[model samples]
Target: MSKIVARGAGVVSGMIGGAIAGAVFKQVWKLVAGTDEAPQATSDEYGWGEVLVAAAVQGAIFGVVKAALDRSTSRSVHRAIGG
Candidate 1:
């Protein structure tokens, strides 16, 4: 059924999308902070601005990835169902 396919594809695509976003965030963070290790808010070494910026970047990347994957998976499911 198309509904089942959509659900399964959504779940799988969501997981993969998260992974993609995390990888993208890591690369972007390294570029922005010049280090692979992300800053923690609780750490005094990293200021509030740095921590907030990292969070914002991660959230943005995740949102973008989710949206893209959702659209792609929906189309794939429809095609699979011959709709």
Candidate 2:
């Protein structure tokens, strides 16, 4: 359905945006902290637990942001249509 496709596209865009933002923030943190790498456990150094936790947090944040934006856009469209 069109709604499903739209939602999927939104999620993909959110994920891409989140990833780029996360990477930029990580780099900035490194620069500020004078570190060469992220403080979190690297893939090769740690088990899946850390990675999964980080991912879940990121996903939740991304979902919340995406939902807020979607709701705002929908309201704007309804207002435009005098609904």
Candidate 3:
């Protein structure tokens, strides 16, 4: 039962984390690039450097958000299960 609960929590947390990460990335990109839109890989207007930088920043943000949320959820579930 605890495993089942943890699995469910993980799924929910993952979804929430993705949303938070995406929003944070958008804001960060706006500040860093002075634009609301991050360049897609195939965008002709942006050079390779610009596209790579945006991808790196976005990946970092998403990783941090996911790790944080996963850690928090695991701890909460552990405590709730009296472990």
Each prediction's Cα lDDT score? 0.91, 0.60, 0.97
C-alpha lDDT (0 to 100) for residue 64 of candidate 2: 69
- Runs off by more than 4 Å, candidate 1: none
Candidate 3 per-residue lDDT, tens place, 29-68, comes to: 9998899999999989999999999999999999999999
Error of 3 at 33 (Å): 0.9
Error of 2 at 53 (Å): 0.3
User: Which number leads on TM-score?
Assistant: 3
lDDT of 1 by residue, 1-83 (tens): 67887898899999999999999999999997899889887899988888999999899999999999999999888887888
For residues 12-81, what per-residue lDDT tens digits would candidate 2 score against the true structure?
6667666765665566556655655544555677468755655565566566666766676556555655
Q: TM-scores, in order shown? A: 0.90, 0.50, 0.96
Clashes of 3: 0
Model 3, TM vs. native:
0.96
Please identify model 3 stretches exceeding 4 Å from their true place: none
**Model 3, residue pairs in steric clash:** none
Q: What is the C-alpha RMSD of each candidate to the true structure, in Å?
A: 1.2, 5.3, 0.7
